[model samples]
Target: MKIFELPQTNPLSANRTIPNVDSRGFHYKDFETMKPEDSKLGDAGFYVGIKATCVYHSQTERIALHFLDFNTRVLTMRTHYPYYEEERFAKKYLSKAPIWRKEVATIDIDILYENDDFELAQHGVSCKDKEEEFLTQKVVRRSARDHEFYAGINGTWEPVVKNYFARKEYDNYEFILKHIRKSNVLALNEEALIVSQLWKKRGLKRPMDSLLEPFARKIGTDKHHLFRLTCVAIFLGHLRLDHKYEFNLRTPLRLRPDGVYQFSRGVETAPWGF
Candidate 1:
């Protein structure tokens, strides 16, 4: 099934406001209402915000419910967490506040997931492909507003974990069933998110110099070599992880100030078994 994204703002009604951390959000005081036994110490309980009714269209129409649980005190465009069983969440939290109950809304899953222009609509872009307007004023690029992460490029673990177990099935699925899967498809993966934030804050850019030029003759002109070296430098600059790593080879890699990677002879070769 394709990923479903709930509209951040309430498009159902004009007067409704989206419940976020800053607005009608779950508060630390609200957690006090839950019985101490039901709540754990030092555990930051979740916030149930925007709710949507998802209807699956097929031979037999199926209906499902989903909620966005924005963690307490976290503030970001992608702060909402996906949760199912809206009744369970309501029974636990919404009984106390009547006004907050207004945040819940209904939606069609097919309109959001299967539509061709859903990507453009979700970002609030207002432009039509008009042939008459050649010199139309460009207010902003759609790419700037679109930050949703897909699989593979952003180090998202959902697809990775899914692929690992998908190859084989066992009578005992218990090995993989116990883990809680928090759906985080709305935002970039943790690594890319951090990098993007750092890039904006620090004005970071990939240096366009090659340190592997000296070894280029030996290694030849493989693009992967340059990409690998660039990634190493990027990790060092953005992640604050400068620890030395040993590859399963005789050469030792080092980073140069120009953001290029250099390799030198190691003092000792790896053991044959290694």
Candidate 2:
């Protein structure tokens, strides 16, 4: 399913207004009380924002739902197990919050697992081709407006976690998983052997200028080498190297930087099991 439909919204009619305070407390007025002309959708004279967030696991195609009412600041995040009873998964991942702010929204959503197979077969597949179909699905109809608003925001949570990962020092699979869970970026195996291998060999202390010559030689005549090098640099940066020499060993030979290199003092212990 497309990422955009994960969150869906519907405009409210204009005639709607804040429910009058009564002996019980404040509550929304009934839709029946409003006039037909005033009740037209999108005419809710005042702002009443709603949003829904759904994270889709690329590998398993599972989805987790996070509902938000921008107007009231209420949140209801839950998971539905398609293959099993909804309550089964609900007890584990479902969260109920009356309010959530943008600053902490990413953290809240990150904790929900989007790869639950049972959950995917039930909710994920229903919206596989038409994400907006959830709007009509009774399970999500009550929060359609909220979901739409969330769709409008469009996967902002992933980038936030990725940014955090980009700033940290790379350690092991656990460290990567911490950010990966939050960002939903990389889908490496649990062991992340490739990353571990690169991490182990990344401690060599060669001069940058010397390394550049060999890299340039290996990259000779390949137009795509530049693009590959750029990707390598980004991945290396996420690994958090203090010096350029540390990157040379981890980077593929053809993609190494081809320019002057400066060496810094003080060697840090590498974490890879070589």
Candidate 3:
């Protein structure tokens, strides 16, 4: 089994310092990052927000220990298994929100194992080709509207998380059971949904200005109130989250699987509420 010891860092850097914590992600909230828990196979618990997270199999405890020796921002994190289930609401008020990003990726634990034959067979694949194929599979191809969304902001992206998974997993992790028959931390054995919010390289270029404030004004609401409403919309399923790509404040928001849900504007007492 592979053990990921905490990286040794300088004693002075503030944000980069590592601290042992729980894998529940309780320590990763202050930063503007979002991820969807898409599993249904392990222990259920809260993550950064009051949202339900996803993890599969009985390897939860193994996964949790990796939280040690690292640190990140956290406000709320709800974790669960992400096998098969319908979207559930923590409340009814979130019906008309926006759809965000959602990424479904298959991690190659094949490399993490000791199968020399598999390695030689897969050895011909270059890391560069592997990452490109991974993105093509995980990120949605740009639709007309997707093109428009990125164009509006002059956005840019590059292949990041090449071998690092801020979050990642297999479709049928039992597949892992069929191969690397052993017990160890998921951080190593599973090839892990390991790693914190930031890494040595990130595929994000944050917008330079305040996109939320300006849009709030356009919609006749203050940024704070609008921001909260947006969060609610996301939590309520108005927005879908594919954590594969990184985002900043000004990313042109769009609905997914379909278009945005437009609720009847009548009888609503406030602009920010239903």
Each candidate's clash count: 0, 15, 43
The local distance difference test score of each candidate is: 0.24, 0.26, 0.26
**How do all models score by TM-score?**
0.17, 0.20, 0.23
The worst-scoring run of ten residues by lDDT in candidate 1 lies at: 155-164
Ranking by lDDT: 2, 3, 1
For model 2, residues 1-274, the per-residue Cα lDDT tens digits are 3221232121112222333432223122321222224322322222111222333322112211211121111122222211222354455446652232221111112111122131211011222223343345753643443344334433222211111121112222222222233321222222232332333354234433344444445446232332233223333222223333223334432322322211222233432221
User: How high a TM-score does candidate 3 get?
Assistant: 0.23
Give the C-alpha miss distance for residue 62 in model 1, angstroms. Answer: 34
Judged by lDDT relative to the true structure, which candidate is superior, 1 or 2? Answer: 2
lDDT of 3: 0.26
Q: lDDT score, residue 51, model 3? A: 17
Candidate 1 wrongly placed segments (more than 4 Å): 1-79, 82-88, 92-210, 218-224, 236-274
Question: Can you write out model 3's per-residue Cα lDDT over 98-131, one digit (the tens) per residue?
Answer: 4323421121111111121211111000112123
Looking at model 2, report the run of 10 residues with the lowest lDDT sum.
159-168
Score candidate 2 by lDDT.
0.26
